[model samples]
Target: MPSAPSERPLFLDPNLNIIFSVTLLAVLGVSSIAPVFPTVARELGVSPEAVGLLITVFTMPGILLTPFFGILADRFGRKKVLVPALLLFSLAGSSCSLARDFEVLLLLRFLQGVGAASLGSLNATLIGDLFTGRRRTEAMGYNASVLSIGTAVYPSLGGALAALGWYVPFALPIVGLAVAFAVLFRLDSVEVEPGNGLGRYLRDALAGMKNRKVIGLYLVSVMTFIVLYGAYTTFIPLHLSERFGSTAFAIGLIMSVGSLSTAITASGLRYLARHTTSERLITYAFALYGVSFAAIPMLPGHWLVALPVALFGVAQGMNYPVVMSLLAGLAPTEHRAIFMSANGMVLRVGQTLGPLIMAAVFAWGGMARVFHVAAGICIAMFLSLPLLIGRK
Candidate 1:
């Protein structure tokens, strides 16, 4: 149950506010540098394709290291893992200012991703630790909303900053240091039991993910990202550029509108959840995404594109909080970090796969077909909702 506003200690607790602000930087870490890639490639005399390694190096490490950090967060205290991770994330992300050599910069970006492994998992784990029931749903919704807001703000911010200098784009995440300092003083430590060993650590993590309930949620997360990001990242820009003659700024502006819509819808999900079970909301959200994706390729003009993107964003926002809240609630407290970490890993896998899968579809067909393919994938999952999860 939610505490009455007057009964609560603060309107928005300072410590939790810090946590939410730091959460915004998680999206910033990788995304803030994206628009600068071509500039970095030109400056360093590297192929743009090779420059793409920046994203891969940064993202791949998280896939491998997040689980390790999850176990560490569980074995040690939250601050023990979080403070160092936050500092490292700030330093590694900001150090692009000094990356005279492209290879060295890749190393720094990889380390930054390693550092960021803790931010999303641990932050949400802390939310899990601190809140439950309606409050828990609200916290997850707010966190997802912040991510949507960051998505809206950062890419264009990166483009603007990159115009000034490639190095300037990385500087924003340095704000994370302030949040780290706040967390150091404000967040409380968790009481973790001793870990058995490496074998048990692996087993326990696997067990949590392997549980019938968790597996469905994990698959849903992966597929949702694949379909959403696949169409959004790979084909949307190409379609807009080719079909509508939109420039980088115009494209960014268009995409940000959807992100803004998502942030608004996700923050209000608490009220939506009151009327509909998480399971039902997820089902409807997936269906909405499917229809939106399928409709994009069929849209006759540029103005119609905006409507589909907004629909997709709202669906994504609605789906994400439910996914996070369910995972947090279902996961056992002792093993919750590992479970959350697994979901993070699954998310990255979907993101990585999304473009690749769509690119294959794009080659076989064309840009318009990418959305149709993605729609098929989304619809398949939407139809599976009945089998995968039940009414809450």
Candidate 2:
């Protein structure tokens, strides 16, 4: 089903440059702010548990809005949905720097989340549009690698900015505006056929979901984020801070270590894809997640903990691109946006619930227990996948 490669090298492809930019900007939502959570909690007079709401509220809107945005993209055209969403994301997200109160900051983050709801799904949708076979895999690997770069840099950038003031990191979303301008003026629109009708489109898309394998992928997506947001992104910084009194800059550096490893693994995904099935790679990813997570809470010091974090990076780098490429391959061309958007919706469900549920775990058992519990969940998921998704 895959098409032949373009004459131009992937790096020279302008369309891909735009997609990579989108991927880079998309990660700014969480990674840029996470290292600052402890600082926020201390400065704003809230418990660390309450600060977790920052992640929760930002992800909540995507759960409800992504499907509709997908439908709109499928109907009107991708740019029609993407440009406005980028504008909204930039305008609302950057405004957070002005908020003095926690409630006000949450409200701003919710609005920014609305803009973000479609970005990830659309980013993947465009890949499905342009490339196929090994080309698509290479593109997915590069896109994910860019995402890894964003994740790796933003925390350190954020932590460094947080040193200036707690609110300074919030101002960084302003860069989204520049990315939005590039997307609007430079990124060529992918052609989209207007569907038969909204009702008919919904029917066909729903029919695609009836496939058990597709459903299994969605379920896998949910569990993957639960462990990621709950254990890695949401709490690990807190764990470092509370246990070792690590500074925001120090926490960011430790967090970036994992992301750096992820970028390295993702850059090599094409070779990995040739050697093994995506399903097997994903299985191995969860295994790495369990091993890394179980080890993190037991490590004796902050800097030493980077060892396990690097292992978790391998899991993350393997998990995201493989799952996305498989999903893109499975989705029908006509309904790909909605199908990918549905993936986005479930991802939000995982992201939203991850911190809230983990917050409960943190409240009950404290920070160290959170990683131990998440480790158990990853192992359970690794075991359960064979049953839910029959071997390809």
Candidate 3:
């Protein structure tokens, strides 16, 4: 059995408040740029189709690198990898503000994605390291809430900055990363058990892959990103531009409304944490997410559209923490980072595929149909929830 929070000494406690704050900032940094993708593409002289590659660019490196980073974190220490990774995230984010061409921007964005992957997986592992049982569940719920809040705020904030110039959105990460670095420095490092180097790390990762529950959770994570991000990254801006003749500022406002829903619902998610198991909540959350996306195409205009986005935000905020908490629970204590990294790799695969799929849909049927397809994908994922939730 896991130790209770009261029994764990405060000094060595994983200060969830600080950890969550950093996570919020990190997510905010990434999401702020999401709403501004169309504008950035226009400014850089790229097509929306080409610009969609931004998501892929950001996701690919992390997908490729996270397993290694995860193993390193498991073998070395979470703090050792997390702190430096934050520094790298900050630096790359700043460089994004200075990119002179699409190529440079793409390269920098990939590097930034790598940093984000490291931070995201490490944060979950850290939570796993610090808390257990009910406290762990509660922490996971709160983490989900913070992620929603960040998602809620960042796009509008990014949109607001994008009004000044394209680079403004890129600069947001510097501020977020700086804060993350400060928080990371104050945390004490956790000790890791010694391992048999590369061979053992690979073996453990493969073992994690073989676990049905873990694989299901990871697939859910991937599909969640693909559907949520695929739509958000591709259609939201287009929808704004089409329906409202939205400027960057206007787009920010619309996306911010969605974020507001996420932020608001996040506060209450901990209550659900107290009442429900992670498995059950995730199944329900994904079902709600599908329903929410299905509603998007039905909403006729920008003013009414916020309702769907807000609902989606609520589902998203509820889903992630539970999924993450469950992932942490399933992973071996000694290989937490590697397992988390593997999960990230699967998520990136979804991230990579989502945009390409959406772009093709956009080309075939226009923007409105993309949401319909997203709804379909979400429904398929929701159907599989029964298998995942019932697992031991």
Candidate 4:
């Protein structure tokens, strides 16, 4: 007789359950505020250019602080850093709900970014600590899937809340915080050995930076995120608003479709992991993403435009788990957290600069020209795939 699927335990251990909850909450808290940015900016009396700074402020601190947080996770323990980080994130997020001015909101957002960095680096490191080989890959796949779900669901919910008031969206993180607190209380802590001081950490980080394979992965990470996020988050809203007269609700609907695609694909990544090598999957994913970017500017309107964006979402959903799995496999266990943190730092450089670069291109030409330019950069990234594949 075939055993029923429900007979098996959902998690192998209670700790995995706790960790998964923490990860889900952490992602939800960070992403939920994004959909309300347009509404919030209007209420605060800021220009769209200035409102773009919100994205910058949220990510820049992760660029600067993630490395240190990763090291701390290695030296101490993942849970040790993760719990306190979530607490701060929750508090900082609540504080943002109270801000009366753009400057104050930016400051709070920066601190929120710092807390986000700590939570992200440590969460991944903890998974690496708990799982191995195929199990590790599966864990990462599940994590990616949940993260995509948060990204998809939060925007619509945020938009709905924003209809009430801008501050309503900011308060949503408290729900995430409540979930995080539950996980923190239930999870057992893992013990970690002390790491070398700052000097040794710096030496190891520098050594990783010099490795060609590592450098390639870092470049791909930066470029992929810059192109994907820059287009969807920054330009797409503007494009809809300018060309089709999109409102906050309408933009949220478009974003929701992409997020839905990402969530569905991400959920199936574990099955894909069984058939493909991480390097090969990433190469194919990037190629598709590049093609999608190149197609976007060519589309004439929203109905036609969504096809490319949906393709991009599918490519991204497949790509991230593979990229992250490869990175986790490459780093030494002792330094895994720090290595991930460093990768994040590089990604932030891309995140911080991508919008600014897009803004410049938009100024020089316009949105249509800027999309073409972004497509050009993506094509360059696609051409680099052979370099990535050859190394494997």
Q: Looking at model 1, how many pairs of residues clash?
A: 0
TM-score of 1: 0.88
Q: Rank candidates, lDDT, best first.
A: 2, 1, 3, 4
Query: Which 10 consecutive positions of candidate 1 have the poorest summed lDDT?
Result: 1-10
- TM agreement with the true structure for every prediction: 0.88, 0.97, 0.90, 0.90
Q: Write the per-residue lDDT of candidate 2 for residues 79-195, one digit (tens) a residue.
A: 889988888888898999999899999999999999999999999998888777778878888898999989999999999999899888888777788888888888876677785
lDDT of 4: 0.72
RMSD to native for every prediction? 3.1, 1.5, 3.0, 3.8
Q: Evaluate model 1: give its lDDT.
A: 0.76
State candidate 4's TM-score: 0.90
**Model 2 lDDT, residue 32, Cα:** 94
The digit string of per-residue lDDT tens for model 4 on 1-392 reads: 11123444534556656666666665655356666666766788886566767778877887888888888877877767777778777778778888878999889878877777666656666667667777677777777776777777777777777788787777665655665676567766556787677688668767876777777888888887687556667777677766876666666666767767877787788777678766767777777776776776677776566677778778878887777777788787778888888887877777777777777777779887767877777777767876854435
Candidate 3 lDDT over residue span 1-392, tens digit each: 23355765432345776677667755754578777777777788998878878788877777778887887888878777777777777888778899969999988988887777776777777778777776776676667666766776777788878878888788766765655666566664468866777787778678766887887888888988888668865677777777677777677777777666766666577676677766777777777777777787777677677777777877776777667877888787887778878887887888888888888988899887888888888888777788865633
Backbone collisions counted per model: 0, 0, 1, 0
- What are the clashing pairs of model 4? none
Best by TM-score: 2
* lDDT for position 282 in model 2: 85
